[model samples]
Target: MKLATYNVNGVNGRLDVLLRWLDEASPDVVCLQELKTPDARFPLKEIEKAGYGAVWQGQKSWNGVAILGRGRKPILTRRSLPGDPDDLHSRYIEAAVEGMVIGCLYLPNGNPSPGPKFDYKLEWFERLARHAAELLALDVPVVLAGDYNVIPTALDVYKPERWAEDALFRTEVRDAYKQIVDQGWTDAIRRLNPDARIYTFWDYVRNAYGRDAGLRLDHLLLSPSVAGRLRSAGVDRHVRGWQHTSDHAPVWVELSDD
Candidate 1:
């Protein structure tokens, strides 16, 4: 099975790019982040016409998440992260598809660190860790894929020193990411291409893409059962160069049936 994750940035604005990728890639399952549209405007018709069924949790002008299953409807499982009741951002969504659980998320950006936003980012990470632990305990085949918004290691960024103080690369955030992975989840891409300088995102400014300056912000974490089936993983880097495309490219993993 082929599973993929993409942060479309704006579902409506980039609908064409998304559909084109869908047709080209044909992944069996897809997790999407940053829809930046309200639920009412999710464009189900267009997606369905593209030969996929989807369930999405959307927010206007901001964070959102969705999961798409090719030739099947993703069984809705959860809509929001469980830890905070008042936290109503459409940043997390889960579904059951193709005999596995898929969790899609768009973690906070937390820019201009050392402030309230950064604090919230950390708190959210903690919540995600707790929930992820619970998921691990289930011992089922699962894939947690999304735009994590955290540059996990120095190797993940183009210039480690320049982003050292940034929220995404800050010590605290990387530690939080480590905490979750330490729970026995395998980072699929890193597991398959261990020493490669892989990147899934590049800023529009400074000709970042042309300069090959990028960051591996999007990730797919597989549970032990699912990890055993991981056959290959990669990023569709060319998608990032498409006209009016998102800053993030699609990241994916291929799994064996057994």
Candidate 2:
């Protein structure tokens, strides 16, 4: 089975790019983020026509998330992160598909460090940590995949010092990701491609893509049972070169049937 995650940037604006990729990649399960569209305008019919079933959590003009299953509908589990009741951003969604629990998330991009947005980003990380612990306790097969918005290590970023003050690459954010991984989840891409400089996102400015300046912000963390099934993993880097494409390329993991 193949599972992939992508931050579409804008589902409506890049519907063509998405459709084209879906046909080419044909992943069994796909988790999407940054839809930038509201729930009522999710373009369900278009996605269905591409031979997939989807469950999405959307908001207007900004963050959104979804999971699509090939020839099957994901069984919805959770729509938002569990802690903050008032938090309304469409960032996290969980579902059951292909015998595994998938948590798709678009973690906050806390820019302009040392501010309220940064604080919220940390708070959100804390909430995710708490919930992630609970999910670990379940002991069922689970794959946590998406744009975590956290550059986990120096190897994951092109210039570690350049982003030292950036929220996505800050010490605290990296520590948060470490805490989650310490809970016994395997970082699939790094595990499979340990010596390579793997990256999934490149900014749309400064000719980053041309220069191969990129960051591994998106990830797939697998629980022990699911980790055992991990067979291959990689970034769809070519997709980033396409016209009208998102800054993020899809990251995927192939798993063997247990």
User: Against the unseen true structure, what C-alpha lDDT does each candidate score?
Assistant: 0.95, 0.95
Clashing pairs in 1: none
Question: Residues 1-258, candidate 2, lDDT per residue (tens digit)?
Answer: 999999999999999999999999999999999999999999899999999999999999999999999999999999999999999999999999977899999999999899999999999999998988899999899999999999999999999999999999999999999999999999999999888998899999999999999999999999999999899999999999999999999999999988
User: Judged by lDDT against the true structure, how good is candidate 1?
Assistant: 0.95
Candidate 1, position 86, lDDT: 100
TM-score of 2: 0.99
Query: In model 2, which regions exceed 4 Å deviation?
Result: none
Cα-based lDDT at residue 130, candidate 1: 96
Q: State the displacement of the C-alpha of residue 245, model 2, in Å, after optimal TM-score superposition.
A: 0.3
- Summarize candidate 1's per-residue lDDT along 1-258 as a digit string, tens digits: 999999999999999999999999999999999999999999999999999999999999999999999999999999999989999999999999978999999999888899998999999999999989999999888889999999998889999999989999999999999999999999998998888899999999999999999999999999999999999999999999999999999999999996
